[model samples]
Target: MKKTLLSLLAVVTCAYSAPALASGGTEAPPHVHWEFSGPFGTYDRAALQRGLKIYREVCSSCHAVKHLAFRNLTDLGYNEEQVKAIAAEYTVTDGPDEDGEMFERPARPSDRFPSPYPNENAAKAANGVAPPDLSLIVKARHHGANHVFGILTGYEEAPEDHPLADGQHWNKYMPGHVIAMAKPLSNGQVTYEDGTIETVEQYAQDVAQFLAWASEPDLEARKRFGISALIFLAVFAGVMYRLKKAVWKDVH
Candidate 1:
């Protein structure tokens, strides 16, 4: 009787834990205010630059911003020479000699950011799952900048009732409360030349803003255009209303 009761209790425990793990039950990411949050908002150039530094020194090992070009760094306040210097730091495969074999050379301003792995298979082999390209990540996620920030800083110890498998980590904001990628940021992980705070929260905020700019470099311009169009339409409507009154007054 005792053995049968122990087996039943074990089965009950597994059954109870299975649903919680499978359901994900992730908490909503905390809200974070951003310079680029509203229609009149614009990207903070200094923050974007700092975020780029973080990406280069840390995130680049596993993630790629394949849609971004070295030349595009100019939008974040880097000059042409600085952009060239940054591009030359990386090597890219290019060209076919007379033998028609691919050759490797320093990256050019025109080249898109290269992937750390040669191909998807290699990336998956190295990491279990391929890290998504970060170029459009801010726009792609539901909460945009806040979501990125949450993931970067959300690492925490698992609850006593919840145990993680090998290679899995607990993230407060991750769906299912588990993530494959370890916490990517730590306090003072990247130095900032501009004297910005070097805490993990600061890094997460700066990188989140940088990803926002990457996802929408023209956000300010688009907002300007939209505002201009709205103003034009409002004025046009007023003028048309006056004309209608002038024209119909005589008829009445």
Candidate 2:
């Protein structure tokens, strides 16, 4: 335990002390910093929608969201009809015949979304890398939002002058940060219907938020319950105090 703690401390110290630069500059780039700011505070409907769009268009090519059901879209503020329409967009496998052949059908509220690749090996073969399953990625990954933002925006080619780390490749911030994946987003990658330019950084932020929220769909309900519990307790206490005083006055 002592050795592990010391090693962690040393790594953290190095990471902090090393001259870290954000993508496109010598300075660290702006990222969406996450914190516990109530349930509603963390949610931005627009960001979630945009993130969904990015996931559908870009990251879905590699990652699978196996844990999420099509019905869960309602939690993200989509109405049932909207959720149904969205679910219908994806094809899910169905039916068990005597020959046991698989068939593709439109996604339903009950069906889980199908992955782009059949498995990790297939994903690697197709994309030159294994696309990660994003079921609970926001919850599972370390320093999630920061990591996501950093990885998405941080893709600089290593300079010949800089020394490379053993496993590292040419990355924007670190030397030899050879990320297997190519930069998915650049400026003007997605031409939004509203004319908003889809920059890589923006997509990163939105998708991170979406994944974070998807991992915790009960966030809004949890917040609401917490608030209600506090209010109920306060009101009950007030009523109890008044009742005790009234009963004691008659006795006195």
lDDT of the candidates, in the order given: 0.90, 0.74
**In model 2, where is the ten-residue run with the lowest total lDDT?**
21-30
**Model 1 spans with C-alpha error above 4 angstroms:** 1-23
Candidate topping lDDT? 1
Model 2 / residue 97 / CA error / Å: 2.4
- TM-score against native, each model: 0.88, 0.73
| Model 1, C-alpha of 55: deviation from truth (Å) | 0.6
lDDT of 1 by residue, 1-252 (tens): 999999999999999877557657666688998998788888899999999999999999999999999999999999999999999999999979789999999999999988999888898888888888999999988678998999988999999898888888999987777788988888877889888999999999998999999999999899999999999999999999999999999899
Best by TM-score: 1
